[model samples]
Target chain A: MRWKLIIDPVGRPGRDNMGLDSALLRSVQEGGPGSGGDAFLRLYRWDPSCLSFGRNEPATSRYDVEKIRALGLDTVRRPTGGRAVWHDAELTYAVAAPCHAFGSLRQTYLAIHQMLAGAFERLGVTTTLASRRSGRAPRPSAGACFALSAGGEIVVDDRKLVGSAQVRIGKAFLQHGSVLLENGQDVVSGVTMGTIPRVCATSLGEVLGRSIAFEEVARAIALEVRERWSGSWSEESRSPETIESDKFGDVSWTWRR
Target chain B: MSNIPDELRYTEEHEYVRSESDGVVTIGITDYAQGELGDIVYVDLPDVGTEVAKMDVFGTIEAVKAVSELFSPLTGEVVDINTALDGNPSLINQHPYEDGWMIKLRVQNLATIEELMSATDYAQHIGE
Candidate 1:
């Protein structure tokens, strides 16, 4: 349950952020368990409001790319799998570790969200996981992540507040996603090609009836991880890997699916 | 419990190798892997004729919760792939050993198949 904590005080571009996360996953994959550390947790935000697609998400045909570019939004495909998420007015968290450290994929997803729900409760906001009982899995046509809650997403009264995706490389894995502090789902809805498109998500600020800063939510989440796992947190920083950014910038990589 | 057919060989990573001829073998994820991965959504396999190194990642399997890498069990060339998986990946969950088979590799050395785990050893490897 030991982990490293990274908080990026200033917002960075989407490519740089994605690059660092991808690089961390590769490092953990190549280094194996207990090389640099067992796990890493990075809380960051995007500059100029980027829109990210999942690793294998059908973005080429499903998204309105011309409109996205015209609206002046940065775009990149995530190393993880899921759907689209608009990376603005939200706190993004990236975690990379050996696959066994988090157990299986579903177990890891559930465990992380459960901790997040606990974190939100500490911040005076109640959260629940959207499961089969809570809602239906999003139809294939659901383009934006927040448009529908998948089984393990964190939701507040049926509105998704956090959307995360995970990818495994050999023995290591990286899971990263957005925790909205403000409702930015509308922008995602507008850039998609779904016929009856609309964003069905809420934000921490909306739930708490007041705006919140990234630091406030970050502190609560960090405290939750420490208290629940009986773990210590070592601080880290983002250092871009050129190979990762170069791959991200390549058009073929973005439309790789 | 997960199925581990006695006729097939296995890798620690959960890929199963089934011989079809002197120099060719079929490959797929074991039933235990499909069970652990849950509902399958997509599979990305290398194109036919692609040379794959032993233990190298040859593709990825995207289940509902995450994307997992698929490693080659033997050094070979991809002779065939399951095109049906492109349209319906859940076949892996419903029938992991039969119709869900992922690829057919033309092995460089047929004897290498014996180096993999037998069903008994695989059963123990998974701590069954």
Candidate 2:
């Protein structure tokens, strides 16, 4: 009844963090296309800031290259699609497993969102799912994924807290997302004019009227995940070999748009 | 034309067309198109009153995998573009045949409709 759980606190540079994400997804996909029912959980953060765009979303659509370079933000592309996101003052996660493990894609997405929502709720922070409107009309912000609330994204008082995107290969599915616990406007400002909408984001400190330790949030997520999923938790650190050969080590892989 | 609906005309890109009372043809992407695109994320459309020629790229649908252009089935002026797609871009993924309808085209030339797919021909063409 218990699923295997991996809680990795990979705090590294933007390049390495992104690389690890890619490496983990590739390994999980190759492990068995997820049909064998095994799942892996990863928790990570970026030291320096970075910008990520989803697959099929042209990098030229939003990112302002010179400005990002000027701000020293690492730029990369993700296997998922939506819009660009600035990675800073945020903890990101990627959950990989077989498609059937979570049933349909929609169900799988909600299950994870609900897990995060529950964690936030436990902290007494009010949260809700984004209201979905149907139509081809353009939204206000076409730049950052979090700037616009789509169905299933976690939002607090009309502002996004967590924004997730997914890429499914055959039966194996890889989902990546970020949670804001601090101000990342400086990182977001590096993108371009009109790309990053001024979304009001609150950290655990702001929500509780006092500061919440980052380690505490991380521990809560790990503990809650173990309890809820009925699994034993282990903190596994990514190896240098894995980081070099697998992640952030190659620009070609990260830029695979 | 193998999988094409007989009552509905087809565009070369495989969209199905059904004529309406106002001389507009209701358009929706064929099953084959959606199946190939994978799970759709965003659906785009040209504004109303836009004129399009046959096979013109009028809109696009972004799937989890990639983005595919939605082509016009015939030369026409767009009468109405589906607005429900703003929040519900997944409609094309859920019900491409029913609620997923994309746009209404006011026939610029009724003859252009004749070039589209026939149900019988489309069925055989798509190997349905």
Candidate 3:
């Protein structure tokens, strides 16, 4: 198997990052089976901090609009489904591949998280994949992504360290996740009405008790993905700017729900 | 194993269709689909009177794990939507075939149902 590693050097707005992820998924789907239709692992960050809610999440009801506006943070609805996430001081990764490569949806989620856990291990941070708990469901009012760990999410000592979501388009799929690098969980919990205690989340810097560079973390994870999947890695040819205009830049798409 | 009622017809996407006498059919996700989705939190349903093409996405189902597109089983116009899902989407997890029916559509062609798989075939398709 061959894979492309897209290491975005600059931080982009929430919309462009999300748009590039979708564009990669579209490219793979259009390329069809084995016509340079290789898998992709993209690493990026959000500029100026942003709040992203799931496709079905009721934004007005869950988030405090006044507080969000005062903070000057951008808000966009994700094409994938999951709870809200505060994108700041974190390393975000998006994987676009064929559905058949990882079997079922749940299987694909676990596989990606397992590889991520391995990446954390290489960086001297131990993490585990959370399992489904047998209990009552959390309230819809719980808006924060790290408020509770869903099945196959990454956790460190039971504290959420990574949050992810997926959207499948026919034979292709895109799974994107945020790997916290610094502190921002309190801001997310405070801006939302949910009760996501700061203790419930952890970051790579917090775990290591030292600062970590985004480039270092991105390289380690990309190498781990190559080793785990036994694939050769190369830089992606196309830039994200090509698809930013009509897809992510449009207000209607960002707010479409 | 998930339930696959012999009387219902199924699509490759795991939606089941039950025909009515008035050339209409009720649609819902199969038990296997609900199991895979795991604790559904929200169901994005299409409005009544919306025309949907066969195999096209009509709406979405969001669970704790992921959001999945709901593919239409046949070409038709929606006549009714399960408004009960607005308040409680878990009906799909509790009773996918009964209380969780998604929509009722005035089908364009009855032959479309014939193109679908039977219960036994659906069972085989999901490896049940």
Candidate 4:
């Protein structure tokens, strides 16, 4: 199956990125699997450094509204379930495909993370997948995606590097993740009320002893996806601005929880 | 292996429905469903009196890794919801069939239950 690679070179607002991910998921769900409908790999960046909480996360309790307002950062709620993520100096990737492409939820997560790990390896960074420890619990109070590494997340030397989440509906699924390009963990921890465990977070710039361009990392990951999935890539012409206007930009969606 | 109660009917989506008095039925995810979901953090169910069609998404179950839509097994109106879940969403993971019951629906068509798989068939479906 040939997958469509949508590379948005321009940085967009948080709402538009979320909206585009949903649009891609809907396209696959309506098109069905193996019906000449292309799966999508979207690589994007966020402007003004937005903070996104999970669909079910209680942001009201975990974040201080006054502090968030003072920081002048954009905020939105993710359709996927997970903790909060601070999007700044990062490469955000979203993969929308037929659910059957990966048999179970866990399998789908591992598949994408593994592909990411391969891409990181190609870029000269060695990382491993986190093991699922039985009976481990998430501290919702922590209020940061990199505070803890869940099972199948990519980590370098026990420090989390990539945080991912998924939203599955009917026949299709969308899994999006954040790959930190620089050490922005302190900024994330300072804004949220909770004490984010900073020891577990790491970034590419910190690992490589120099800054990396967003385009360079995106190209490497895209190359890995092409080699791993055995598919061709093409750019999608239609903009997801319509979906942004209709859904993600709406206040109701950002604070629905 | 997950538990599959013989008295309840099941959907391929892993939702289970138990018939009640006067065309009403109780709905929740099966043991297999909850087990797969893994420590549900939140359950978003429709309020009482909302109408739903068969196979339509009625709600969502948010786990640590994913948020999955909950599909209604039969066309019906939500008559009751487990409000306790607002404070303690883990009930679904702890007791999927009993304390974790999601909602009660006044079924629109009693014959719709016939379309669901029998408990034995559901056990086979999950490879129990």
Point to the candidate with the largest lDDT: 4
Clashes of 4: 0
lDDT of 2 at A162: 83
Question: What TM-score quantifies how close candidate 1 is to the native fold?
Answer: 0.91
lDDT by residue for model 4 (B63-99), tens: 8888899999999999999999877888888889999
- Supply the DockQ value of model 1: 0.48
- lDDT per residue, candidate 2, A98-213, as tens digits? 66667655677777888888777777777887655454423213555655566677887777788787766544667778887775644554565653565555555666676665
Candidate 1 interface RMSD value: 2.7
DockQ of 2: 0.08
iRMS per model in Å: 2.7, 6.2, 1.7, 1.8
lDDT of 2 at B83: 90
Q: Candidate 3, DockQ to 2 decimals?
A: 0.61
The superposed Cα distance between candidate 1 and the true structure at residue A150, in angstroms, equals 3.0
Q: Show where candidate 1 strays beyond 4 Å.
A: A32-35, A132-142, A237-243
Write model 1 residue lDDT over A1-257, tens digit each, in one string.
Answer: 56777787788878778887887788787873344655778889999688888877888788887998799888888877777888889999888888887677778888788888888999999988887433223333357778776677899889889988888888888988899999977887787775746678999999999999999999998888777754667775644333377777677877665
TM-score of chain B of each: 0.98, 0.89, 0.98, 0.98
Ranking by TM-score: 3, 4, 1, 2
Q: List model 2 lDDT by residue over B1-128, tens digit each.
A: 22334577765456888898878889988776665455576766899999998878787666643434677888889999889876777677677767888999999888777876677777766567
